[model samples]
Target: MEIKLCSLIALLGFLTIANAQTVFDITKCGATPNSDITAILTKTWTDACASPTGATIVIPAGTYKCGVVEFKGPCKGPITFQVDGTLQAPTSPDGDSWITFCSFENLAVTGTGTFDGMGSAIYGKQKSKAVVTSNGVQILDTKIGTGDDCISVGDGMEQLTVERVTCGPGHGISIGSLGQYAGEMPVKGIFVRNCTLVNTQNGVRIKSWPDQEANDVSDIHFEDIVLDNVDNPIIVDQMYCPSNLCKSKGASKVTISNVSFKNIRGTCKLPEAITMTCSSAHPCTNVEMCDIDIKCTTGPAKAVCTNVKPVITGIMNPPGC
Candidate 1:
């Protein structure tokens, strides 16, 4: 495969600060067995990504334990948390968010490390709310876990992108419709590319409430993604009636348009191959699907479109070419 990928950028202009930025090096800070990391990470000794731009947070190779990591501002602009080790959070059953970056932009997490949200004790009737928070979160060659969404974008989220991310054994990536409240504003300008999934619920999905609805979702594109043992591969199921109380309510107005899928291959072990349940009134249109390959053991490859435009140029399997 080509090493071509786009960078996820968030907006926040910065001017003052040392070297026009700052660096938080956890290694040189001696935050180990002898050092008090919690204190160093506080305003007394240190602070979490505050007033940072053109700055980098370096977590050199080590296993560090933390709680409720919240990034406070200027999280935009070439910020790299070169995670060279594991940053783990406590396990909670009550369902809590591991790391949250709100009202921030231009963030990237890179390294051969992990962020373990020891949340094995948690359970949810659904795996869709955790990622409803921010924008421009890039999981490049990094491992994140436990919490509801490895990464979730909620309200006022635009230009959000997830690339080269490996998520599984946790809640998959969910692009929400923002319901009727904060939960119902609609995520736009989303681009998910070159990612892998293990045992996720729905790989590459666009979810909406059974009741709430958004006006329109423009400039959304998902491409070059892979799923090993995911359930719903290519799901655009806007007809979802959350809790099954009203899947037929037809209040789903989240129009997903200008979507292009290319080089997407996966194995759907549960639901149908491509479950495209859109509104007949305002069916999703201008969708260019090229090179969609799937390997389903039993079921068939069935695609339903109302007023949508799907250009199938490549295939493999019974759904094969």
Candidate 2:
């Protein structure tokens, strides 16, 4: 077919020129709003925009303070850390993963900015955290406050998109405890839809079961959301993890296939708003819930629905966790 349409138009012009390299203008990197990125990439972007196939460093706004910021391979435009202000890190004596993303691609640290990992300016609890490795990611409308899990996804990541984000007071977005059995392409196409969590502890967490040989965190999806007073709003802890705080434990055997929680609306101080655990070697498959609405300050507001096939009907409070 004409050489397969000329090799799909030269692989879509080499992935649109590998996402269009470089662009940093954090107000010319001498930014104010309290600047001092401790040499944010040797003073504003590109100490190395890593090029085997990577580079897109552009931040336009103000407010600074940085640590452990890394991304490699496949980038064009959206490495944009564009916001109006704030991007911090430093505490826990200094740094662990203030912002350490891995094998990156198409990152968009959106506006309304603020990545303050002051993490209570660290004092232990292994000094708060951060880490998102290898993948095609897009984190939009950012405002993540970390002392822990304000975002952590590793092990050969895949398509990830945590859009319209807003997690405060830590430990919210997670994708693995891929410890103990060690690595692979575990985290798959994960989509955390329009998010919002305040006073957090565990707003939206999807993990592989506690170590054995944790498998694939398959095609998962979390829909339109909002939660306040969070303390375990939506979780899949899997059982015993973070190895009491990431010493790189284990747990995950893939297969959390096509999971979905659609039209989610919430409120949680946790009397069990949403809690999912599917393991038995990667169990929870093709799970779905539509129009879920939850509100809890007390209890009984949970309306569980398990492996629901064709039996879901405009659910209001149909939770069967």
Candidate 3:
């Protein structure tokens, strides 16, 4: 009876090993701890995603110098890229984004890691630290900094949640600058909560193109966020023409609606604490704010509103409209 029991136990252990999920450590696939591992990472990702059951690609703890790390897939099953180390972007990445997740489904990027975009080296040239275009995506407990937006969400993303993340020394979290390209898709159903922004240009911004209408972004929520000396604490910029480049002299093309900001308190680096400039042709609707408070260092914080109105309640500093 003892021998039979031992055999059964060994069989169960072997089965567990066989059925367990796979974890692909990048180190095993020619990724050095302190080198530019872009090519190695690409190969590792391809191998891991080829598994019959989805796998976890682990970026272990070290500073990995890389350029243009993009993971693209309609992967076989749910996939996870667990970053337990720092991903360092080159001074000149030769691309707009440092890291990109394109066309993925059910992807989760979670871990206590840092993504350094080397912003100061290439200020105003780099676009963003990370750009994500995926469905059922969750980005949690990560730190990001870049010259442009810390995290930019692309179109056609659904069921997205960004929580407990910190951003700084860059443009804050943004959605849109949408409606700029042909076949542009709408982004909806986003929830951003428990995030902190420090020393950033803009915080919690939603922007669209100047003219050429036909994209819609709706059903957004930003709650329980802390901002430390951010330039624009809360902004909805419809006339999002940089360097005065919009020649049409028309309102923005994108339509924004059903947005809410709740329990946000912080300091504004600029005098304009809150700015909501929507389009006259396609104004923003159903905007709501609660427990919003931010003060400027130079003067009394003020809000700049045009072409839209918001329902305000409880402790608005610059005062929303």
Give all candidates' CA lDDT scores.
0.59, 0.60, 0.80
The most accurate candidate by TM-score is 3
Error of 2 at 275 (Å): 2.4
* lDDT, candidate 3, 1-321, per-residue tens: 533443343334322126465677776655678898887778767766776677787888999988887788888867888988988878876877667788877788987777776657867775444344578888898787656787787777777889998998778999877766777778888899999999999999998878865788899899999999999989998878777766665777788999999999989889888889999998899999999989898789998888888999888877646
Candidate order, TM-score descending: 3, 1, 2
Model 1 alpha-carbon miss at residue 57, Å: 0.8
Report the candidate with higher TM-score, 1 versus 2.
Answer: 1
Using lDDT as the measure, the top candidate is 3
Summarize candidate 2's per-residue lDDT along 1-321 as a digit string, tens digits.
533443343334322244555444444434345655544443333422433344344444566766665544454334545555666666643435445556666665566666665544454635334344556677777777766677777667778888888888777887765543555556778788989888788877766545555466667788897888777776665554554744433434546667677787777776777766555544566777778777787666664323323234486663564
Ranking by lDDT: 3, 2, 1
Clashes of 1: 15
lDDT of 1 by residue, 1-321 (tens): 111110011112112456676555654444553232443343311233544346666666777776655555454355655677777655552334545555556666687877655555444422444444456756576454444555555656777777888877655666664454533555677888888877776777665554455556667788888878777777676666655655357546567688777788878676465666666556777777788887665566555454465666666332411
Task: Point out where model 2 deviates above 4 Å.
Answer: 1-44, 48-85, 88-155, 158-166, 169-171, 174-184, 188-204, 207-215, 218-228, 231-234, 237-267, 270-274, 277-296, 300-321
- Clash number for each model: 15, 26, 1
